[model samples]
Target: MDTCYLCGGLLELLGTLGRLAHYRCIDCGMEHSAGIDNDPTPTKERTDNDTDMENQGTSDSNHD
Candidate 1:
Protein backbone atom coordinates (compact mmCIF):
# COMPACT_ATOMS: atom_id res chain seq x y z
CA MET A 1 0.00 0.00 0.00
CA ASP A 2 1.11 3.54 -0.65
CA THR A 3 2.11 5.82 2.21
CA CYS A 4 2.59 9.55 2.70
CA TYR A 5 6.26 10.35 2.16
CA LEU A 6 5.99 13.47 4.35
CA CYS A 7 4.44 12.05 7.52
CA GLY A 8 4.66 8.31 6.95
CA GLY A 9 0.92 8.11 7.36
CA LEU A 10 -1.54 5.86 5.60
CA LEU A 11 -2.80 7.13 2.29
CA GLU A 12 -6.28 6.98 0.81
CA LEU A 13 -6.67 7.24 -2.91
CA LEU A 14 -8.66 10.29 -4.03
CA GLY A 15 -9.17 9.06 -7.53
CA THR A 16 -7.50 10.35 -10.70
CA LEU A 17 -7.13 13.99 -11.55
CA GLY A 18 -6.19 14.61 -15.16
CA ARG A 19 -3.45 12.06 -15.88
CA LEU A 20 -2.37 11.73 -12.26
CA ALA A 21 -3.78 9.63 -9.44
CA HIS A 22 -4.37 11.51 -6.18
CA TYR A 23 -4.01 10.34 -2.58
CA ARG A 24 -4.54 11.86 0.84
CA CYS A 25 -2.98 11.04 4.17
CA ILE A 26 -5.41 9.83 6.81
CA ASP A 27 -3.58 11.44 9.72
CA CYS A 28 -2.06 14.63 8.31
CA GLY A 29 -4.62 15.24 5.57
CA MET A 30 -1.85 15.84 3.08
CA GLU A 31 -2.75 15.50 -0.59
CA HIS A 32 -0.48 14.10 -3.27
CA SER A 33 -0.73 12.89 -6.84
CA ALA A 34 1.37 10.71 -9.10
CA GLY A 35 1.31 9.27 -12.56
CA ILE A 36 0.33 5.67 -13.09
CA ASP A 37 3.09 3.19 -13.74
CA ASN A 38 3.98 2.51 -17.35
CA ASP A 39 3.30 -1.20 -17.46
CA PRO A 40 3.88 -3.01 -20.74
CA THR A 41 0.45 -4.59 -20.32
CA PRO A 42 -2.41 -2.16 -20.55
CA THR A 43 -4.41 -1.44 -17.45
CA LYS A 44 -7.97 -2.60 -16.92
CA GLU A 45 -10.85 -0.97 -15.07
CA ARG A 46 -10.79 -1.47 -11.32
CA THR A 47 -13.56 -3.55 -9.76
CA ASP A 48 -14.98 -4.10 -6.29
CA ASN A 49 -13.03 -7.35 -5.94
CA ASP A 50 -9.86 -5.46 -6.70
CA THR A 51 -10.57 -3.08 -3.84
CA ASP A 52 -11.34 -5.96 -1.51
CA MET A 53 -8.00 -7.55 -2.31
CA GLU A 54 -6.17 -4.31 -1.67
CA ASN A 55 -7.98 -3.75 1.62
CA GLN A 56 -7.04 -7.24 2.71
CA GLY A 57 -3.37 -6.59 1.82
CA THR A 58 -3.20 -9.64 -0.36
CA SER A 59 -2.12 -9.88 -3.99
CA ASP A 60 -3.03 -12.36 -6.68
CA SER A 61 -1.08 -15.54 -6.20
CA ASN A 62 -0.32 -15.57 -9.89
CA HIS A 63 2.33 -12.92 -9.34
CA ASP A 64 5.75 -13.98 -8.19
Candidate 2:
Protein backbone atom coordinates (compact mmCIF):
# COMPACT_ATOMS: atom_id res chain seq x y z
CA MET A 1 0.00 0.00 0.00
CA ASP A 2 1.25 3.47 -0.79
CA THR A 3 1.91 5.63 2.26
CA CYS A 4 2.52 9.26 2.96
CA TYR A 5 6.18 10.25 2.91
CA LEU A 6 5.78 12.47 5.94
CA CYS A 7 3.57 10.41 8.25
CA GLY A 8 3.47 6.90 6.80
CA GLY A 9 -0.30 7.14 6.76
CA LEU A 10 -2.42 5.47 4.12
CA LEU A 11 -2.90 7.76 1.16
CA GLU A 12 -6.17 8.49 -0.59
CA LEU A 13 -6.59 9.89 -4.07
CA LEU A 14 -8.00 13.40 -3.81
CA GLY A 15 -8.05 14.36 -7.45
CA THR A 16 -5.97 15.25 -10.45
CA LEU A 17 -4.24 18.52 -10.88
CA GLY A 18 -3.34 18.60 -14.56
CA ARG A 19 -1.95 15.25 -15.64
CA LEU A 20 -0.90 14.18 -12.18
CA ALA A 21 -3.08 12.73 -9.45
CA HIS A 22 -2.97 14.27 -6.02
CA TYR A 23 -3.21 12.22 -2.87
CA ARG A 24 -3.77 13.01 0.77
CA CYS A 25 -2.87 11.27 3.97
CA ILE A 26 -6.04 10.36 5.82
CA ASP A 27 -4.35 10.50 9.21
CA CYS A 28 -2.17 13.59 9.14
CA GLY A 29 -3.83 15.54 6.33
CA MET A 30 -0.60 15.58 4.37
CA GLU A 31 -1.20 16.12 0.69
CA HIS A 32 1.01 15.34 -2.32
CA SER A 33 0.84 14.43 -5.96
CA ALA A 34 1.37 11.00 -7.32
CA GLY A 35 4.74 10.31 -8.88
CA ILE A 36 5.07 9.16 -12.44
CA ASP A 37 7.87 6.76 -13.16
CA ASN A 38 9.51 6.20 -16.48
CA ASP A 39 8.16 3.02 -18.00
CA PRO A 40 10.00 1.21 -20.76
CA THR A 41 6.66 0.21 -22.33
CA PRO A 42 5.22 2.48 -24.96
CA THR A 43 1.84 2.96 -23.37
CA LYS A 44 0.72 6.46 -22.42
CA GLU A 45 -2.03 6.04 -19.88
CA ARG A 46 -3.01 6.89 -16.35
CA THR A 47 -2.26 4.62 -13.45
CA ASP A 48 -4.40 1.51 -12.97
CA ASN A 49 -5.69 2.90 -9.70
CA ASP A 50 -6.96 5.98 -11.44
CA THR A 51 -8.50 3.94 -14.21
CA ASP A 52 -10.24 1.70 -11.75
CA MET A 53 -11.66 4.64 -9.89
CA GLU A 54 -12.94 6.11 -13.10
CA ASN A 55 -14.54 2.84 -14.11
CA GLN A 56 -16.29 2.72 -10.78
CA GLY A 57 -17.87 6.12 -11.44
CA THR A 58 -15.81 7.87 -8.81
CA SER A 59 -13.70 10.85 -9.75
CA ASP A 60 -12.09 13.80 -8.07
CA SER A 61 -14.68 16.14 -9.45
CA ASN A 62 -17.43 14.04 -7.96
CA HIS A 63 -16.12 14.63 -4.46
CA ASP A 64 -17.19 18.20 -4.48
Model 2, global lDDT: 0.62
Candidate 2 ranges with C-alpha deviation above 4 Å? 38-64
List, residue by residue over 1-64, the lDDT tens digit for candidate 2: 4677777788777775566676767887766665454211111346799878778954457534
Among the numbered candidates, top TM-score falls to: 1
Compared with the true structure, what per-residue lDDT tens digits does model 1 show for residues 1-64?
Answer: 5777777888787788577777777887777767776211112446899888888956466754
Please state the error at residue 43 of candidate 1 in Å: 25
Task: Provide the TM-score for each candidate, comma-separated.
Answer: 0.52, 0.48
Estimate the TM-score for candidate 1: 0.52
The parts of candidate 1 lying over 4 Å away from their true place are 38-64
